[model samples]
Target: MSTPWHIQRMAALDFEASDKDSETARIVSCALILVGGNLPTDTRTWLVNPGIPQEPGAIAVHKLTDEHLAEHGAPAEQAVPEIAKSVAEVVAGGVPLVGHNLGGYDLNLLDRECRRHLGDSLEGIVRQPLTRVIDTMVLDRQVAPYRKRVSEEQGPYQMRTTAETYGLPWNEEQAHGAEYDALMSARAAYKMGAIAHTPYRDRPDWVRALRTNRFNSLRGVTVEELHERQIEWYRRDAEGYQAWLRDAAKSKEKHDPEAVIPTAWPLRPVPAPRNGGDR
Candidate 1:
């Protein structure tokens, strides 16, 4: 059988933002890593001066201080458009975009940044739906729905944790840096592709331990088909989680029944302007 598209080529994208709120967060740094083919990985990165105060918590994670960014980072107006153009070019070339929590976070943040600065969302710039995406987080959750947090130090689906799970090297010092995170996600994707394509009998003990047959469904699929599968997988997972939250709320547990998990894949919809007019 032919190689899976993810095993052949992918453009891994990541962004470090001003804060965790994707709707309001500004891009502080971003990276895109092109993997596969005979050539070495091509990495492009940008640091942006968001021209706003970053949350201290966000600063602690990515370590890009407002003072430092103001002095050295490119203006967001310039950086955001360049980032969008670069990603659009890669997507137009039919390469799948890979990242951890891409649909739930990075892509949504990028769309916000583009609309805030460039007056267009990334989808608007690309002029098409982002259908070629491989979200390592979504894939991992789908394949190993029962994976549990091994310790207080890490969440099971964090990029570093996922990298470790997949047998890739991890550097704590580089964990939150956009470039490093993007590269690690790409490496994890390669490993996941290997697992999916490898015969079950030949798979390692860890693969067998996953206790799920989902990887078998991934074998031999085109990138577009895999992308479509993730959309459904993510939607189902979100619905399940939302339902669990409602059940907890009904039981008088401390969960929010009103909490909603977005089912969008690759990019979430842009919120309407608060003033009831064009943003």
Candidate 2:
């Protein structure tokens, strides 16, 4: 049998934004890294002058300040389209796009930025659902729903912690950089493919300790099939989380009962304008 698509060539994508709001955040930095087979690894990065102030909390996380971006970054109108075209080229070539939490965050942010700056979304350019994308976070949650947090400092499914869980190298100094994070997520996806494709008895003791057979079913599936499976997995996960938030609200916790989690995979729908203009 041929190698699984997940274990083959992939283009890893990541983006750093001005803030945490996917609908409104502007892209501060973005990266794409292509690696696999006998080809030499290729990497591209962009820093955009978002034309907006960077939030203090976002600055602390990515360390790209307003002054720095103003001096060194490309205008959003220029950078956003170039970034979208690079990603479109990757998808057009049949290589999967790998990232951590891309469905919920980065891709949604990119879509909004493209619409904001270029008047066309990434989905508009691709002309299809991003079915060739692989989200390491979604895959990890599906495969290891019972895994516990490593410590107070790191959540169970954070990219850093997930990389560590897969025995990939970690560099604290480079942790949140767009290129570094994208490469780490790609490596993690490669490791996941290894775990999934390996035979049950042949898997390492550490793999056995994960204590689930979820990866077994993932073995040998086509990328499109995997994408469909993730849609279901993500929906179920969101429903469960929404239910938990409702329960928390009933118990007088700080959670909002009316908060709705979107179940869209890879890209979310654009919010309608307040005046009811076409989205």
Any idea what lDDT model 2 has? 0.87
Q: Model 1, stretches more than 4 Å misplaced?
A: 249-254, 275-279
* C-alpha local distance difference test of each model: 0.87, 0.87
Residue pairs in candidate 2 whose N, alpha carbon or C atoms collide under 3 angstroms: none
Off by over 4 Å in 2: 249-254, 275-279
Model 1 misses residue 204 by how many Å? Answer: 1.6
The root-mean-square deviation over C-alpha atoms between each candidate and the true structure, in angstroms, is 1.9, 2.0
Report the lDDT tens digits of candidate 1 across residue range 226-263: 88999999899888878777777453665777878778
| Error at 53, model 2, angstroms | 0.6
lDDT of 2 at 12: 92
Clashes of each: 0, 0
